[model samples]
Target: MRNIFIFIIFISMLFVSLSACQKEDEKLKGLVIESSSVEFGSLQNPEDRELHFRVQINDYGMESEQEYKVRFIIQDAHISDLIATEKIEVPETYKTQLLRNDEARTIVTGGSKEIKKDFTIDEIRKIIEKDEAVIIELYDKNRTIDREVVTTFAENIKPLVKVNPNAKLEHIKLKETNEIDIFSRAISDSNKEQGISYIAYPEYTFSLAEESYFLWVTENNGRIMNTKDTYTIYSLSDSSLKEVKEVIDKK
Candidate 1:
């Protein structure tokens, strides 16, 4: 009888352990590092030379009873040195909330963060020149969820400079125009209110002057956001009409 009882207890414990492992696996499957990018600070300011990078994370799992935390580590891949670290927490109630009434289903979710580090212009240039300039790793505790090795910073790094108010603002106007276009066509009819953002690079004129920038139109519908130069838009369904129009006019 005693032997049978002991076996039963062991079997129950093993079942619980297996269940927990499976739950964790499911949660991880819903999580991802959606996108990452590097932004350079003002080049003319000797005291304010810096590098700012953003990492966007998303969790597509069901609402959790407990809070969870994830981390991102950036390193100089060539030298094996740590550059920066960022942490994001998903609160206990953090999950996509859907509103289903008379209109379309509006899903609301948010998760994004930015890290800034000071580096000299020369140091920054040299660091990015390496074949593998930067290595970004995402961790859920000790387990690595994702790893991205950036070979060249040419496409990722967008240099910033002081704006001359008096100069013609053609590029800024163009970016605003693009945002309005997205707002009118894609966002106006849907359940989402449009919000557009971008990182503008210093315009270069070798052959002919052209507008250069990274634009993102978000309609908050999911947990993940993209922060790269690409034109991938997120469906985040919350924003004010006045705010977007103001941005267009001010630009």
Candidate 2:
């Protein structure tokens, strides 16, 4: 009788362990990182000498009960072993939200999300080389969701500089049209009011001459709020930007 009882307990424990393993497998299998990379472009620094780069987050993941946090580590990959790196944090949403009154089904085949984080290229120059490999790894706790490696060519690096945010916005019409426009056009916009968040105040900025400008990025009820540079400001004035350009391309 004692032997039979011990065997029964052992069988039950084995079943429980198997079930737990299966659940964890399902959670990991469903989350996919389609691609991870860095984007190079004109940055939003005042001196106009800085280059811009951002980590591109293109991923597919299963819906969860609530918002989850994911991290990206930027590392050097040109050597035999991974070298210098930096960390960036991002918050993501899963499909676990309750459906609306008009909704019918709760099951979704898959969900896709795109995210980006901007950084100045000058900071990481020590680890950069000609055609050097830049590796970006994505993780949730100790589990690695995905990894991407990119080679740099013709990328520039320099000492970081202080962009003049204190440049005053003078409220005066231009006598002669030239470069410095305190308030320029908003290259993009948040279609909905909810997604709008301003990172750079309009009055504190001087126009950067790059073809592509920057803006504060946030989301509203599933809508993304970001703006680019459209045109140049003709004059230097301290006037309220809203009165001049309407949208000052907040970065």
Candidate with top TM-score is 1
Off by over 4 Å in 2: 1-35, 39-53, 58-70, 77-85, 89-132, 152-251
Per-residue alpha-carbon lDDT of candidate 1 for residues 31-144, written as tens digits (9 for 90 to 100):
544555444443343223234444454443323322334333445542323233332333323233334442222222223333233233445556655544554554445655
Candidate maximizing lDDT: 1
lDDT of the structure predicted as candidate 2 = 0.36
TM-score of 2: 0.27
Candidate RMSDs in Å, in order, are 18.7, 17.5
Q: In order, what lDDT does every prediction score?
A: 0.40, 0.36
- TM-scores for every candidate against the unseen true structure: 0.29, 0.27
Q: After superposition, how far is residue 86 of candidate 2 from its true place, in Å?
A: 3.9
lDDT, candidate 2, at 30: 40
